[model samples]
Target: MIILVAYDISDPGRRDRAAKLLQSMGLSRLQRSLYAGRGGAAKARDIARALERILDSETDVADILVLPDHAWSRRIEVGNGRARVPGRARPPGVHIA
Candidate 1:
């Protein structure tokens, strides 16, 4: 199970809280608003509920993406940067996706 959390929070304090909460759950920060790590669907739901408590629904938005661990086998990455999406290294070439 791979849990990817992406959020757009309106408040700085809320954003930091969300980041810390995700990190505490073992998800690493892939970017300012993205995180990923090993977790189950139940965990994802629970995290979503937790976010509901932490976020202002009218102002903030968060997405908790739950994917099977094996999904990474087909992971495609591009752009001039290190592999932001975990579970595999970027293949050599110019990947369009």
Candidate 2:
């Protein structure tokens, strides 16, 4: 399965923080606010829990989409740039719980 996360955050700081958090959690950034990775329900739950702490309920919204094997197999890409894996790179002095 594949897990995709996208967010709309009002605060620049929180938005950047969320991106770093997602990267550290093993998701690859497909765009500025979109990410995709391989994970299950447990992993998606974990991500939601982590994101909740940094996102403002009133102003921020994060969407986590799950794609089954069949759906992922028919995926289409029109861009030349590939998804870049962030590989444990996190913000300085930030400790992810």
The candidate maximizing TM-score is 2
Q: CA RMSD for every model?
A: 4.5, 9.4
lDDT of each: 0.78, 0.80
Which regions of candidate 2 fall more than 4 Å away from where they truly are? 81-97
Worst 10 residues of 2 by lDDT: 88-97
Q: Write the per-residue lDDT of candidate 1 for residues 7-88, one digit (tens) a residue.
A: 9999999999998998888787666787878788999998999889899999999988998756744555455344544444
lDDT of 2: 0.80
Considering only N, C-alpha and C atoms within 3 Å, which residue pairs clash in candidate 2?
Answer: none
Task: Write candidate 2's Cα lDDT for 1-97 as tens digits.
Answer: 8898999999999999999999899997776788888898999999999999999999999999887866765665544343453343231222324
C-alpha lDDT (0 to 100) for residue 61 of candidate 1:
99
